[model samples]
Target: MQKKLIDDSFSIVLGKQGLDLAKILDEKKYINEFIIAKKMNLTINQVRNFLYRLFEHGLVSNIRKKDKKKGWYTYFWKIEKINTLEFLDKEIKKRIYNLEHLLKSRETKRFYTCERCNIDYSEENALLNNFICHDCESVLVLKDNTKEINEIKKNIIYLKKELEEVEEEIKKNKDFLLKKREREIKKEKRLKKQAKEKLKKKKINEKKKIKKKTKKIKSIKRK
Candidate 1:
């Protein structure tokens, strides 16, 4: 099994510990729905709805297990890391393309704004309003793109860096799976050895019991 690039279990502090749902789901191979609900401090149905949303995006999968005594089914969830990375890759590509378009617009077109009202207008809107603020009835100032454009460019750069990190995590997951498989194989070998020893011990005990019984019978006959 390969690890996914997106930190499904990745939690980001979105203003005071508000966790990103995608990150939380990405970390576990299989997680119980109830467990997720408890961790998020939400109702089971809320967690189920969120999980279903992720499932629609192909981010998670679930397995249902029936309890023999209770007669109800429990669902266990797992992250689909590969699909998640692909989804993210597609999303980032679209964002980058949009940013490129915005950059071109910033470079080529004139945009105006009302500083007081915090309203922005492109060249067409400004022309329609005769370069005036519609809301505050004030003159529209020529908007500066230097700071805003730079910030957007910076964000694009950061997104690319995050994408690279996700790829690294994917590789890391593959190595982890390989190691786990090896460990399981070793465990199976150990269990087989233990079973053989147990059977050997049982046979020895049986033989001893039979020998003792025969000895008792022969002594009773002599008496």
Candidate 2:
């Protein structure tokens, strides 16, 4: 589900080209741009163009490494998963809001349509024209908005549900990242503790060796 949303968000931002690039991008690690181009069967410039578009939207991030031998810099790209999800969330909310607004308009306002010409007009326009079709010169009938209103309502419901799922996915990803950070911290602490212990043991062993050498010299002088 998360993948689907990510793909959709990419497609929305960068179209089909973005979707193709997104398929090869990594969530955790950065991938070489050349490899991405190869996988997508596109030129490096084409891949960069798509990536730059995503970058403009904060959907992807990049790092550059300079090659001493080649005297050039290469970029690696990774998907910003959380940002992508957030973008999708905002987009879905906007869509839902617009759908609700349209639904309200349909329920409240009157619409007139010319059946022959298949043209529609608002209440004010229809009133100004005396409820007559401007093109077909036929009497304009009041359009039943029930079907349109219901469709808008259904779309709103679907978008709301999708928003809920996106929010949940965002929460889960955040939790997973937090847990991963915690594990990394603990591992670092453990490694530091082990290093300290090893150093302490090494010092103790060195001290013991010095003491043994001193005792040997004293016994030799007494003998």
Candidate 3:
């Protein structure tokens, strides 16, 4: 389900071609651009173009490696799953907000449509035009907004449900990242503690050797 959302976001941003690229890109590791191009049966430039489009949206990231023999650099790309999901979630929320506003407008206002020309006018405009189609010279009938309102309401419900799912995915991703970070921090602290213990033991051993040397010198002086 998360993968579907990511793919949908790619399709929205870069169309079908971007969706194809997203399918091939890895989330865990960076893939060589040349390899991606070969697998996708596209040119290097085409692949780069698609990657750059994703990059602009912070959906994908890349690193460049310099080739010693060729004295040039090659780029590798990877998909940022968390960022992609977040971006999709934000866009979905915006769409939902717009849909809600439209639904409200449909329910509250009156609209008139010209049957012949298929033009829509708000109540004020229809009133100003005297409820007549200026272009077609036909009568402007009051549009039954009930149907339109119902459709808009349905769309709002669907978008809200989708947003809820996307939000759940985002929460999961964030929790996973937090736990991974905590483990890394614990590992680092353990390594530092071990190093400190080793240093403390070495210092104690050095002090013992110095005390033995001093005692021997004092005994020789007494002799």
Best by lDDT: 2
- lDDT per residue for candidate 2 within 1-223, as digits (tens), equals 8889999889999888878877889898999999999999989999999899899889999999999999999999999999999999999989988888888888889999999999999999999999999988999999998888888988888889999999999999999999999999999999999999999999999999999999999999999
* Alpha carbon deviation, residue 118, candidate 1 (Å): 1.1
Candidate numbers, best TM-score first, in rank order: 3, 2, 1
Clashing pairs in 1: 8-23, 8-26, 9-23, 9-26, 9-27, 10-23
lDDT of 1 by residue, 79-160 (tens): 6766666666666667778887888888788899999999999999999999989998899999998988898889889778
How many angstroms is residue 200 displaced in model 2 relative to the true structure, after the best TM-score fit? 2.1
Per-residue lDDT tens digits for candidate 3, residues 1-223, read 9889989889989999878888899898999999999998999999899999899999999999999999989999999998999889989989988988888888889999999999999999999999998898788999998888888888888988888999899999999999999999999999999999999999999999999999999999999
| Ten residues in sequence with the least summed lDDT for candidate 1 | 9-18
lDDT over C-alpha atoms for residue 72 of model 2? 93
Candidate 2's error at 19, in angstroms?
Answer: 2.5
Clashes of each: 6, 0, 0
Alpha-carbon runs more than 4 Å astray in model 2 = 67-70, 133-138, 221-223
Candidate 3 vs. true structure, TM-score: 0.90
TM-score of each: 0.65, 0.85, 0.90
Residue 176 error, candidate 2, Å: 1.3
- Score each candidate by Cα lDDT: 0.74, 0.93, 0.92
